[model samples]
Target: MRVLITAATFRSHLYPLVPLAWALRAAGHDVRIAVQPSLVGDVTAAGLPAVEVGRGPDFMSELKKSIDSDGGTPPGTAPSIDKIVVPHIRIAEAVVADLVPFAKNWKPDLVVADPAAFAAPAIAKAAGVPLVLHTWGPMPDQLWADLTSERTARENWPKDLVAFLDTWNVELGPDYADLVVDPCPEELLAIRMAKRQEARYVPYNGAGVTPDWLDEPKRRPRVCITWGTTSEFMGPEVLRPPLLAIEALAGLDVEIVAALGKAGRELLGDAGEQVRVVDWMPLSMLMPTCDALISQGGPGTVLAALVNGVPQLVVPQISAQPLGAELLTNSGAGLTLRPDELTAESVVATVTELLDGDSVRPAARELAERNAARPDPTQLVATLADLAAGR
Candidate 1:
């Protein structure tokens, strides 16, 4: 069977689809990731074949600039639904023009896609194949959209997206999923969609190695801190969390391991011999050794921590990150701090509270166990095979 996977032009969006792709390939199905030209390398890096489609701009840059131009998100508010979804829609539209043609040529039996990858429906419709939407961890974006759409048409994806794809000859709608694959624990989700298929999360942190420090015994409580994955494209200003995190917990006896991107690594100067800063280390490996995690609320990052049962302190920056922050806090598995609320004192207090108290540990551990109990991706291959074979 031939499987075609599609994603928005971002690593966070692309990574969620990898596990299933891996499962399909292992089962002897041909799988190729269809993405914008720039993301082809990421697909290949994950050891899958990539088919380059239409052009797309730097969406992270566009998102950063859009947020900056609006003077950042309001104190109590996240960036608007349009601001977040529009960039994805734009890139998805760009990929569709080429994608429709490719799907016709490849004639994939199934199409697996990121929920945000709006182009997949057109491909599924064009090729007369089954389309399945896969999610990335806690999906606050969809929750927010569902809530906001109730009050205004602007925030509704199915309505707005259907109208947006008017030019395409095929019948396309955002509601076009034959099955929905979810890896997130129910505790982390606020809203549930229809036709959901439960799948265990397989973390795909791009091209990596096990660090040497993993072999060393921890002399104290270890904390894993990261700036999430999108900061490099946004530039240095977005790299402040790691610096502030170091400051917040400076006098504490905890060992800090900061996983940063290229910009974050450069921005972080010498933080003494106690701090371990690596440019790219998978949190899946690091979270198991840590006592707590502190980072921005990117679904992928937080889910990595959650899967390992690590208590978290999220500093939400953009889009549905705040929504994720709220759900985590409600679940008692984690805590949240808005950008305005972030401070040395607050971070220290939260970190200490999570570390010193056993309050959230049970919930965090339960959530992890529940997520681990979900059907693995290899198991989902049969489900997809059935869908492809019209079962």
Candidate 2:
């Protein structure tokens, strides 16, 4: 069987699918990823075949432009409709058009998609294949509906704007997908996505092949700071404060490992000792040894920390981050701070508390065990293969 996966261009979005894609191939299925051309290298790096879809500035570049024009830092909220949803909708349409010609030729048996790329389901519908929606975070269906209703209800929108906004809600009706895979956990999505018969709560997909470094010794209590793939679009103004806050913990006995994406490196160059910036590191390898994580509240990062039994301090980038952060806080594994209210003093204070407190660690360990106990995705893929074959 051949499977086609349509995902956003971001590494965070595409990376989670890599393990499962490999699992499918190992089980004798041909797997191909349809993503932005810019992400081709990453797809190939994970040893998956690449299917290029769409033409536009890379997703993050367009996002930066959106911020630059919108004035200063984005307000804290669920990803702004303009920032994430609209661009993705455009990218989805472009990706669908890009994939249609190939779909006609390749004739894949199944279409797996990241929900943001609405066109994947559309393409699957056109090709008449089983559509599987893959997610790293809780899929916010109600929030999506609210956003759609708000846009359509806007009397201020120009006629053309109203039509474009209506396009945002196109995926809401039937003909969406056959199944939705919430790869995080059922507990995480219980409040947000609820109990939908179509939804399956699988474990995290990209758990990563453990690296040899896990056996080595290190002196500094390693601290990981990351914002994940879309960090480039999320300006440093929102992220830097947290780092400065960490730096305020100057005398704390920890080595701060800031795994910055490209944008973070550019913004906080040579912050001197007590801070180290790497372009990227495989968190699966690094998180296990880390003492604590200070992050911008991306779900992927939050889960990585929790699954590794590492506590976290989240200064959420937006509402989704806060939502994930809130889950962590509720689960007793982490803490959250507002970016606007975050100061170096607050960061130091929070980090000190998390590191000094015993409860967070036990909570983190409990969460880790819970995550580890979820179904292995390789087995799930085997089952999915059977379903796709109508077994």
Candidate 3:
């Protein structure tokens, strides 16, 4: 079987799909990834065939600009309902245009797509292929409301964006998906919402496949801190506080490994004796050793921490981060602190609180165990294959 996997231009979007693509290939299916032209190298590196979609822009630059323009809120900061609804439509429309031909030409038996890359489902409909929508993040209520209001023309988005996304609604409304894989656990979603779709409970994407670096034993309690690669651009300024805060916690018999991207690594100076800074490290590997995680609350990071059974402290930079932090707080697995309000004392206090409390540890352990018990990727791929075969 030939499978075409589509994802948004961003790395966070692309990485989750890689493991699944590899799994398909291992099962003797022909697998190809349609993504931004710049990410062809990453796709090829993972041994998946690459198909270019968009004329690539510097993703980090675009993200930084968006974060700057959007005014990244500190942790625990919530976005106004309006901001979430409008901008995403514009971004998705632009992304969808690039992806259409890629999907049409590949004409795979199945198309697996990130939620943001709504174009894949549309193309699959047009090409008479099965579609699977892969959602690795929160399904925003604002987005649902926007889609629901399509008929009445009620939306918070600008006229241009609304017009663009509406085109897909008109083009592929009924023939959308055969299946939807919500990589997030059911505990994350308020309720299932898709019609004629099965929502599978898969663990966070790109999580828990151990890397080669973590086999070494360590003396101190290890703590993993990373604000996804997007944070490098969106919340570069937000990076300083976490680094500084960690320095203060150096005395607590803890060892810190901070995964900052290129920009973050440069900005964060030497991380001293107990703390180390690296340009990048696999979260799947680092999370298991870490006792606690400090993050910018991106969906991937939050889910990675949850799947690894590591307690977290979220400093929400933007998007659905505040919501994630809220969920963490509600679940008794973590705390949320705003960036502006963050101090060395606060970071130390929060880490101390998590360590002292049994709830954070046990809750995280329980959730991790639940996620670990989920059906493996082979089962999911077979289920998707059955959908494609119209079984």
RMSD of each: 3.3, 4.4, 4.1
TM-score, model 3 to reference:
0.83
Against the reference, the lDDT scores of all candidates come to 0.79, 0.68, 0.67
Q: How does each model score on TM-score? A: 0.89, 0.83, 0.83
Candidate 2 clash pair list:
77-319, 245-344
lDDT of 2 by residue, 1-391 (tens): 8899878777667766776787788888888898888888788777778887897746665555555566735443234555555456667667767787888789989988776666776677667777777776655443333333343335432333335434534333333456666666555563323222322222243335554545678677777788765444444555565457656767688878777767777877886777777777777777878999988777667767777889898876665666667777887888888777787777777888788887888888887887777665677776677658977
Off by over 4 Å in 3: 56-105, 145-162, 165-176, 195-213
In model 2, the runs with Cα more than 4 Å from the true position are 60-79, 141-175, 190-215, 229-231, 262-273
Q: Give the candidate order by descending TM-score.
A: 1, 3, 2
Candidate 1: where are CA atoms >4 Å away?
60-79, 141-155, 158-160, 169-175
Please, what are the lDDT tens digits per residue for candidate 1 over residues 1-391?
8999998877888988888898999999999898888888988988999998867556776665667776786443455765676666667677888888888888999998987777887778788998888988888645323533333433455554655555554332235478889898777775675678877887776777777779788899998888876565555677676678887788898888888767766777787767887887877678889999988888998888888889999988876687788889999999988777878898888999889888888888888888888899999999899999999
lDDT of 3 at 182: 66
lDDT winner among the candidates? 1
Worst 10 residues of 3 by lDDT: 196-205
Question: Which model scores highest in TM-score?
Answer: 1
